[model samples]
Target: MASNRIRKSALPGFRFSIGFTILYLSLIVLIPLAGLVVKTAGLTFPQFWETVTSQRVLASYRVSLLTALFAALVNVVFGLVVAWVLVRYRFPGKKIIDGLVDIPFALPTAVAGIALTSIYAPNGWIGRLLDPLGIKVSYTPLGITVALIFIGVPFVVRTVQPVLQELEAEMEESAALLGAYRWRTFRKVLLPELVPPLITGFALAFARGIGEYGSVVFISGNMPLKTEITPLLIITKLEQYEYSQATAIALVLLIISFALLLLINTLQRWTNRRLRSA
Candidate 1:
């Protein structure tokens, strides 16, 4: 005979919750994206293509993508090191250093831009020291990468820190006892666990660097085809009241960013599945 009792769902009201979630996401995310697409649709294909492919606009894309990529890569390396240091050792001012990592998140981006510009300007303190070597940090592409790196560092450190914390030191010791070198222990043991979170951090930092505006604006010096970023180009178009052109450029950025993020997420998922199987 069939059991008399009915099986209850582990999550009661899951249907209602899922419906609300979809509705919320639609209102907040889908609607805005739809509006962006609709606004761009006002342009003919030729107009849209021309707006996004202009020499100045194309230059901005290159500068933005290249600097953002460099910054994110730098952050991934340095951030991981910082996270490891914080988790694996205690030093004087450790707490202070940890607190400092979040400064970019709390500080106003405009303020960050101004402060970075001041410090890196040719006449400024550090700038004066570096000027003799002919390395210019302010008013150049290097400055833009520096600004992006400053803002992106926290993403990597924060993402990796918790994961590093969860990993026990005994694992490394066990590996050492088994005749593994430090590099071998890290590669054979710790790295697999860290890969997912590192990718997450890289994605976050890369995305932020791509879309960054305020902190980069002042430091970039807004020179067309050199240090100018895509966000700044968007603002310039808006100020000129070229709404259709602005939307077209924005749509291109959106599409590219979405594609890159989708690829990264796919990689993350594959890595996770492999790790689980291992």
Candidate 2:
């Protein structure tokens, strides 16, 4: 009997496209990641563990993770509001506000760093206002979180905006007609549909925060075991020609980021499944 497999998919040149995709991914993504792992293999197991778990490295990890978490959470809340406003309301300068949302995407990271540093520096306008209040932003972990929040907001807003735009206001109206309160309608009707994409946005923001270096190094003051983030430490190691140690720390970061992203994505999938079945 002949095999029943289709030789071609509906997409033109499907096999060729798939082959090219795999080739591209292998060459660009997989190979480099594999190389990083291989380089880290130069260290003994004990050395690898110590390099990744040293006091300074651990502090950096904590700083990165905590700041990313805070930023992601903040974005989830404010981003939802921004997305809702843009999609559901008509107001003056709406188009301009929408355009502004993409500014962070276009801006260079270094420029963002410099702009943020200038705004939040001790002598800068906002910084000077906050100085007497003892609320320092520049060169602190708080400043790092603020920068991450700035860059991450766009991710959440963009992700949720499309979904919100597609959602029918009639459903919300019907809920209200049924005597559903505003809070209850949003909770029961809107929240379910939004959860998956919201989680996706949160994951994206968190991932970006983890990898952020340029925008953070300037604002963080790069203080060892204080303001230093993991990526900055990796750069420090690279600058000192400690390739093995750098790769080891990178590997640990890779593992942790992968695990967190995997967990959030799993939750997203679960919510999607539940919504579909509902």
lDDT of each: 0.91, 0.90
Clashing pairs in 1: none
> Tens-digit lDDT track for model 2 on 127-226?
9999999999999999999899988989999988977877778989999999999999999999988988898899889999998988898899999999
Identify the leading candidate in terms of TM-score: 2
- Candidate 2 versus truth, CA RMSD in Å, comes to 2.6
Per-model TM-score versus the true fold: 0.86, 0.90
Model 1, 1-278: lDDT tens digits are 23433354543897899999999999999999999999998888998888899999999999999999999999999999999999889899999999999999999999999999999999998899999999999999999999999999899999889778777788889999999999999999999889888888898889889999999999899999998899999999999999888889899989888987896788667755754554
lDDT of 2 at 238: 95
